[model samples]
Each structure stands twice: as C-alpha cells, then as structure tokens.
Target: MKCVAQAGLYEARIPTGAPYKLRIGWADGWEEGADPYSFPPLLSHHDLHLFAEGKHRELAHMMGAQTMTIDGVAGVRFAVWAPNAKSVSVVGDFNLWNARRHPMRLRHDGGIWELFIPNVMSGSRYKYDITGPDGARLPLHADPFALASEIPPATASVVASPLDFEWHDEEWMARRSSFHAENAPLSIYECHVGSWRRPDKDGTRILTWDELKETLIPYVVDLGFTHIELMPIMAHPFDGSWGYQPLGLFAPMPRQGNPQQLASFIDACHQAGLGVILDWVPAHFPNDLHGMARFDGTCLFEHQDPREGLHPDWHTLIYNVGRNEVRGFLIASALMWLTQYHVDGLRVDAVASMLYRDYSRPHNGWLPNYYGGRENLESVEFLRELNHAVAEYAPTALMIAEESTAWPGVTRSVDSGGLGFTYKWNMGWMHDTLSYISRDPLWRRYHHDNILFGLHYAFSEKFVLPLSHDEVVHGKGSLLSRMPGEGGTRYAGLRAYLAFMWGHPGKKLLFMGAELAQWEEWDPHGELAWNMLDTPWGRGMHALVRDLNRLHRTEPTLHQRDTHSDGFAWIIGNDTENSVFAWLRYGDDGKPVLVVCNMTPVPRIDYRIGVPLPGWWAERLNTDADDYGGGGTGNAGGRSTEQIVSHGYEQSCVLYLPPLSVLYLQHEGGAG
Candidate 1:
C-alpha cells in the first residue's frame, strides 16, 4: 500500500477502481462505511437554473436528504445551499458525528453542496457542520427542506423516505374542487389539536396525529362542519409559537408522530367528508441558531439590513422575499404540503405584515420599496406567483390569506393584476360583529352601524367570516364570556349572533371551544373545558352549533350565493331604534330565505318584514328554541305573506319575533 498526504490527512491508494467500503478498528469497537466522495452530485444543471429563476416548485424533493439508489447501491442524497461557506460536511450518527469523514462537494453553479452517503438509511439523524467564509466554525444547521425532524429540544434533522402512504379518499380527492367552489358550503372548525382535548389532567399531553384521527375527525364530521382548519403543524422549536415560527418548512411536526401519521390523519379527514386547511407562515421566522437565520454565516434567507429584515412585533427576521431563491424555497414548501401530505388548502398567516413594508413600524424604522411606496412590491409578486403555482400544480387546492387591511383584489384572479387568493379572512366582519354582539341591547341600538357596516362592502373580495382562535386568546375572554348580559341573556345573545353570522353572506369559521361556550379564553398550554358539555348551557350551545352547521350545508339559499351581490338584500336595515334587523338571502334558483333578528329583550309581536314571494313561509330555524337553552318564544310554525306592499315588496309577513333571537323563514310554495 502507498500513502499520499494532503491537508494533514493520509489517503491510502488502492489498485481497485470499483467503489469499496472501509472498516476502521479502534480500541473498543469498529465502524464501517463507504466513502461519500465516491458518488457524483445528484442535482442537475436545469434544477439549479430553475431554482435561481424562482421557478423550482419541486425544490423540496431535490434539496433535502432524499433516499435513492445510485449505481446499484442504496443510500441517501444530502444537498444544501450554502454559497458562502468555506467548507461543508455531513455529520451524524452514521459517522460518529465526524465532520472530517465526509466533506461535501459544492457545485459552484448554484452554491449547492451535495453528497450521496451509501448505507445512511431512513431514521438516521444528521446535520450540516460548516466552516464560514471567515474560516470560523458555525453552529450545526438543520436542513431547511428536511422531511422529518427530531422532536423539539433535540436539534437534529432525521433522514426520512418520501411519504408513500396509501390514500383511501379517492372519491374525496376527485370532487375536492367542487367542495372548495365559491358556491359550496364551507363552514370550518378552527382547531388547535393540543388544546382541543387532553388525555391527561395537566393538559400538557399533546395528541398525536393518530389520536386526532380517532377523535378530532369524527367530532368535526358529527358536528356537520365541512372543513377543519388546523393551526400550523409545521416543525417548530417552540410550542408557544403554535407552529407559526417554523424552521423545517417541509417536515411535519414530530410531536404529531411521523410524516406518514400526519398524512394518515389528513386521509382520514377526507374519508370522513371533511377538508383540511393548514395555517402556513411565510412572512417571518425566528432567529434560532440552527434555523435559516444566518446560514453560511450570512443573512441567506433574510435581508441583511435590520430596517428591512426584522419584524417589529415578534422580533423575528422578515424573509427577503425579493430574493429569487427565497421565493422558490417558500413556494416549494407550500406545494409540498398540498401535494405530498394531500392537504386541501393553505391559509397564509401574517399576510398583512407581508403586504406592507411599514407594517407595525414607525416612519423612521422602515425602508421604502424601490418606488418609495409602503406596498411590498416583491411580496406582492411572490404571492401572485405562489397562487399561480398552486393553481397550476395543485388545481384542487386553495390558497387563502389572513389579510386584515383593505387590500383590494386579494381574492381576484392574478391575470387581472390581483393577488389571486381563493379566499381572504374577513377580519373586519369578525371585529365589527363581535363588537355589536358584546354590547347591551339598550346600547346596541346606538351602535347599529356596527352590524350593518359589513354589508356595505361585503362583495369587495371573497371572504371567510372567521371567529378564529385570535378572538378568544390574550385575555380577550371566551366568545361566551364576551357577551354583556345575565345568564340566559348571554346564551341568547350568542345564539342570535351565530344565526346572524350563518345567515350573513360569507363562509363561516368557528374556533374549537366556542361550540361548548367554554368560559375560559384559549390557553395554548391547556386543553378546552370539555367537562362544560355536561352542563345544560354547554349542551345547548353545542347542539345549536351542530344544527347551524347542518343548516348552512343543507340549505342552498344560505350558501349557494355567498359571494354574489344578488344573494343578499335588506328588508329593514334602518330600524335601529327597535334593535331589529331583517334581510333576505336568495339562491341561484331564486328561492328566498328571510332572516329577522331582535337584539333587545322585549319580544316584538307582529313584527312586519317584507318578502319577495307571496307564499307560505316555513320557519326553518329559531335561535330562541328550547333545544338551544332559549325561551322558546317564536312563531308557532311560520307565517304566510299577505298581498300588502311593504319595504318595496309585493308581499309582507308579520310574525312574533322572540326577544334576543334570530329567525330563519323560507318560502315553501303557493301564493298566500
């Protein structure tokens, strides 16, 4: 054997040309592995070109540790983008965490360092040890595209084979486009799996995906909700972030079992006739040492300038969306969940923060865009590109935005110079309606505009009226506790408010504990008060929510024209003195459903409201029903409209309106 020396390492020359493994014996034990340098780079020139151009929609599959067979040998291909690193190495349990054992080969075209380490199979934990451009050793970096990760507190990336779970929701996937159509019913149950229920008394035991499959899926299905919107489930280091500040963009949270279990949970949801929407954060990320904050000892994922890079509120680093590679990275992450996990939709979080450069910043604390405008032009382009990619790649999936500002054309098509989201959270509607409902009936009259103001611009964008977890957290009180009334009156107010929301022209979303009228505000660290369901008010509130979901799904007039201007018309919108509101909703078939609400405690006998059809109107639902803990004061069955012109209608109906109640009346048939 001949030995040659280079860089303080002695390499023994072998006469054989074929690849071979080496076994090194130590004082106590021996380790054996094939040299990673024996293999060629896995990434191609075209992939790098596409990524550099911000068009690599499948980058997640290429950039991470992917299992493969090269030259008749099975192994895992590890690739990472660290352009400024002086040297990079794959270090893990396979090599006894030795960085010197496998130095990666960097392809200068895209600054991508790659190596195929044979015998490194799935379940092997690993990370990248890098020497910075300044020749200083940097902290080990977790893979940004890791498909699975070590549970938090153990900062290592786990090697995982691609998700290969067998799906049993063929029927659901086939017709998912129809389920997400604007005309279809979309009542979502916003849930935080950790706090929804606890198997233990301390509420510290978070439910795994398999646990949720057996519990959350059936519960949502039984409640008649069309979808379940899970709070962010991406891999994050902090439980307090609720998966918002995700580090592993492509990995499922290991706390919820593996990627396969999460996929199975989603499959179960689909089979149970429920769509799943995930909250995805793309605006900013925490500056954790192992995260993408200063990869390669540079601000690779975020802007270097603090004025443009830092998030004022969360103290996180704002993404450099203007960068081509960053845009591709984020879009690839969005696609991974939709395609690999079979997720139905992504609700982009902190969209308002991304939309404006000066969001939550003082005038001097922010940097203006190229045009000196507050609008983040680069972010706008990225969103449009992201939505366009989702539409092209996963046509059945939806891209929703949690945008609070009055951003025009948020849900409009990209071809028309819009952001091209399928839906936007109607934050204004949630705020104003909650405000109106929280007031005393006597004072509500003076704040009548709060309830009616939403309709003024209801059709501006496709909206999802969300009573999400935000309303019940941060000392704001539970939805039930926010009502300003005595015991029964509070329940009545909540019921009436829910009915009004359902009857309103938008899709619906309710948080987990709102159905049970849980007294405590949302606590991420604690579970919901499930014992509350044993009480009378709790049972009634739950029943009412179930029935409301049923009505929203079964009735065409209620959901068929949610985004159309013609779907809604007012009958007595200006009757603020009596604290009453009346309106009509119409479906595509022209069938009408009249809604009347009494916000005060005094019942109104013979309350007159106009109807378009002179026919027998059946009372479809009453918020004052005894089943929902109400006084049961309502029209005996229904009222027939008389041929008396009122409120510019050819027919009018007079009925007994219950105190603090909402009534739904549908035209049955025949002229009165």
Candidate 2:
C-alpha cells in the first residue's frame, strides 16, 4: 500500500464495478471509479503528429468529448489540449464538481489530457479543471469542442451523443456540386436566428430549431432565396453579441434545442430546396473568462502580446494564427459544420481585420510581420491552409469572405496567389450606393459618379452585393429610413434602390426585415414589426421585394454574364442632368435586359432611351407602379422602340420615366 501510494501508480488491476479510493492525502479520499489512466491512449502517434503539424482537419472526431462504449463501459471520453498545464482534471456533477476526483492523464504526443468516465451518460454537464504552468488554480473552462452547451446563464459543457442523424438530404448532397456560385443563381438571405422571429413582443423565447423548420424554410423558399445565411449558431455566452463571441466552437447553442434538432432544421431546409450558410467567425473571440481567454492560465489560444492578439475595435482576442494547432483547430471547426451539419457554405466574418496587422490601429500600436510589413503573414498562411483543407474535405462547400478592403485576388484561386474564396461581400458597393442614395434627388445629378463608380471595377472579383445586418443595426437606421425623402417618396426611392441592387452585377444578399421595409432600426432582443404588413406602404414594399427576387432569378440576362465585364454596358452614361442612369445587362447568348433608374422626385415625360432591339419592350418591373404603392407614373404595360437611333443604339424608345423609380425592360420576341 505504501509503494502504491508513493509511486502514484496502479500496476495491478482494480476490480471493476466498485469505487476506488486513493487515501494517500490529508484531504478527503477520491472516490473515482474504473481508472481512466489505465486505459490505452485514445489518439495514435500519427494523429498527434498531424495535429502538431496543423494538418488534422478531422479533429472534430478526436479532440472533443466523444461518446464511446469501450469494453461495455458506456461513457464519454473527454479530451482537451493544454500543453502547459501542470495538472488537469475532468470535473462535473458526477463527481460533485471535485477536481481531485478524476485527474486526467497527460498525453505524450501534443499536451492533450484525456480521461474516460464510465456511465457518464449523455446530457451530463462537465468542465476542465486545469492547473497552470506556475501551479496556480485556473478557472474551470467550458469545453472548446463541446457539441452542445448548457443554456445561457450557465457555463457547463454537455455530454452530447455521437452526432448521428437519419438525414434525408441524400439528393441535396449528391447535387451540391452543381450549386456552386460560378454556375448557379446565388441569392442569399442573411438572418439572425433568434431575432428572425419571436412569438411574443417582450423577446422572452426564441424559436426552437423545430419551430424554425416549420417557419423559416418555407418563408425563404417562398421568397425564392437560394440560401439562408444564419449569423453564427455556435454557443456564445451573450445573446446580444449575436453568436459572434462564441465559446463552444463545435457546439450548437442549447437555447435552440439539442444538436440533432439543429440538424433536423438543416435537413428541412434541404428538403424544401434551400441551402444553408453559417456566418462563421474565426477573426476574433470575446474575452470572457470561461472562454478561450487566458486558457490554461496562459495566452494559449490567443497571442501573448496585446498588440498582436487583442482586437482594438471589438475588444476581443485575435487567434494566434502562427500556432499550428490553432490553425488545425479553426479549420476542423469549419469542416465540422460543413460535414456534420450538412451546411452548404460558410461566410467567414471580419476577414479584413484578420488580413491586416495594423487594422483600425494607429500604425505604431501594432506589430509588423517577419518582413516588417503591415500584412499579417501568419494569418494569410492560415487562411490559405484553411481554404485548402475545406476544399479537400468538403469540395462543394463555399468559403466566403466579408472583406471590406480592396485587397486583390480575394476571390481568386490560391494557385494564382489569391485568398481563394468562393465569393466576397462588396462592402465598397454597399457603402457607396447607400451614401449616394441618401443624397436629396435635387443634388443627385452632381454626385452621379458615386452611383456609377462601382462599374469601373465591378468584375474585379466574385462579389456578393450585401445589404446585410451590419447596414441596418447599430443606429445606421433601416433601409427605408436611409432614403433622402419622406412619406411616399422615401418608399418609392427604397423600392427603386432594391430593384437596382437586384439588377446589379453581383450575387445578391439582403438582411432580414428589409423586405418588409422595416422603418425601425433592427433590435436584436425584440421581434420584428411583422404586423406592419397591414399598412399600405408595408404591403406594397413586401410585394415589391417578392417580385424583385422572382425577377432576379428568372432573368438569364441578369446573371448569365455576371462574371464577365461584357455582360454590362452603359447606354446613357452621361445623362446626369436629370438624375437618370441607363445601362444594359446581357446574357451570354447576347440577349439583354435594359435598366433605367430615375432618382429625382419629378416624373420625366417623353424620355428617350436607347434599346438594343427595335421591338415591343415589356415593362418587366416599375418601382413606382401602384402595385408597390407609388404614384404609378410609368408606361402602361409596354413601350415600342422608335426607328430613330439614340445613344448610339440601333433604336430608341420614348416613355414616361416614373419619379424615384427603376424600370427593368425586356425586348419581347427579339432574338440575338
């Protein structure tokens, strides 16, 4: 007994199905059962080698608390990486939250500590009790790889079952390759899950995953949005951060129900012919104590240097991208969502912040990379490796970047020395267009270049023109409120802006509530004013958006040549005198859709515009039409092009240009 106590080792077998107590210390004895140390190593040497090299893209299966039934002892195998910890233990309700009850054994390969507790069934809450390098008591941390977490107001990680679901999305998975952005109609609806819909006004309860399946899927399908981009579904401590400050990178928040329920929601989306995109944040994480901050009582997940690690704008901690394990961890989390949850894509948030070392900082406040350059070399390499890993793991899954900079090759292939993203959010266009439209129409002609400047570099990258949640929140006001005019003029201007955006030369993305022309700035904690649909402006605005989405999808000329510069050309490039702009969007087959926007409040009569073909031009959509609660100043049904040439086109049309309206016209019965 003395030798066993002194050695702190058990060479012989302790009988199973009994509580084994270590009574060597002055404190109360440990009533730990079935020595987890006695079990063989969970990970192989090769696996550890790869993890250290930052190549372990499938760590989701290895690093987290995995449900296993080894030798008929059904329980969870908890594993965590804290290389500098003096000692680590798995503490939970099973052991009365006593850290000494189940001390985990340190792994030899990569500083991973692991312990398997028998009969620790699913739904049991647990956390890691880590001792720091200097032997200080570190705060217990929530599991970084937990598949599900306790509902907010609690910070424990739940023991989740192996993520297995009887998925009925075989058809979607099989045909996903065809849905890539380059060849498909990509219109995304950016949504915040909790704020998307609520039954009550006080914001007490959020819609569950099951409830969302019944509501969100059908709504998106009806609106003809190809994909619904959810703002981070990962488990976060604060609801107001909107899942941006995540603690459990692998776990879906329990507030929405279990992991399987979220899976079922995704399955329902696929069944209803809607793809789902998750807004993934790998840029920075909140500095919550129970989170990645000061992990293992050291700056493990983040950089030790504040200039390099802390985000100036968000007050969060930036990931230490130079660390190989961190890269592996980040990539693995991304792949887990794509592979396990069957998510169609990931829109990587705050990529511009990640790319630059001196982002939002007074130049000297930040550090330079190896070459003394402002570009973060480590972050660049990490992003490249992440994109490579995602491509290899989930070939059809998209990697989008919300990068606001003019950084070249953002959507270009890695082989060509670019970031290799599938699509990029056009922040430049969003900001410029919004600024231009906010000007009074009387002064719009003088600032006409603001509206036309985007086309100069429109095809620079695969861009998703976004009027996202960022535009509507934080006192930026709603889309309806952003217009320069008031009353009916504002409504007409907003509808025109939307139509123009839909016809613009990029993939489309619109935030929720914008379709209803919501006048109030978005409130994360309150339900949207859905009852506004009863009002005239609201009903008309809602109907206009539905028609716009339908028109955007059905018109081949709008998207077929979107990636090419030749697809767009100016028909009336210099007619800024009356605050008017005309352009043509062309299909690859040479068919064209002509667009004319009138930004002023006064209607123009006998306005002559050029058309590609001399035929009956149908009025496909008019933002000022009575259908959209406008003054309805537009050509009745159609306009016939005159034989007289104008603006160097083969023919011209004299029509009524409605005030604060944009018109989409298609040549009826005209061939290329």
C-alpha lDDT values of all predictions: 0.91, 0.86
Q: Which stretches of candidate 2 lie over 4 Å from their true place?
A: 1-33, 670-672
Residue 119, candidate 1: alpha-carbon lDDT: 87
Candidate 2: tens digits of C-alpha lDDT, residues 34-85: 5565566777788788888888878888886888987766778888889899
Q: RMSD in Å for candidate 1, one decimal?
A: 1.4
**Clash counts for the predictions, in order:** 0, 0
lDDT of 1 by residue, 1-672 (tens): 223655556577666687687777778998777766777677899998988887898977899899999888899999998999999999998888999988899889898899999988899999999999999999999999898899988989999998899999999999999999989999999999888888765565878889889988989999999999999999999988988899988988888798889989999999999999999999999999998988999889999998889998999999998999999999999999999888999999999999999999999998898988999999999999999999998998988899999989999999999999999999999999999899888899899999899999899999999999999988999998998889888888888888899999999999999898788899888888888789888888899999999999999999999999999999988998899999999997777899999999889988888788888999999999989988877888898989888899988899999998999999998878
Quote the RMSD, in angstroms, for model 2. 2.9
In lDDT terms, which candidate is top?
A: 1
User: Highest TM-score, which number?
Assistant: 1
Off by more than 4 A, model 1 = 1-8, 200-202
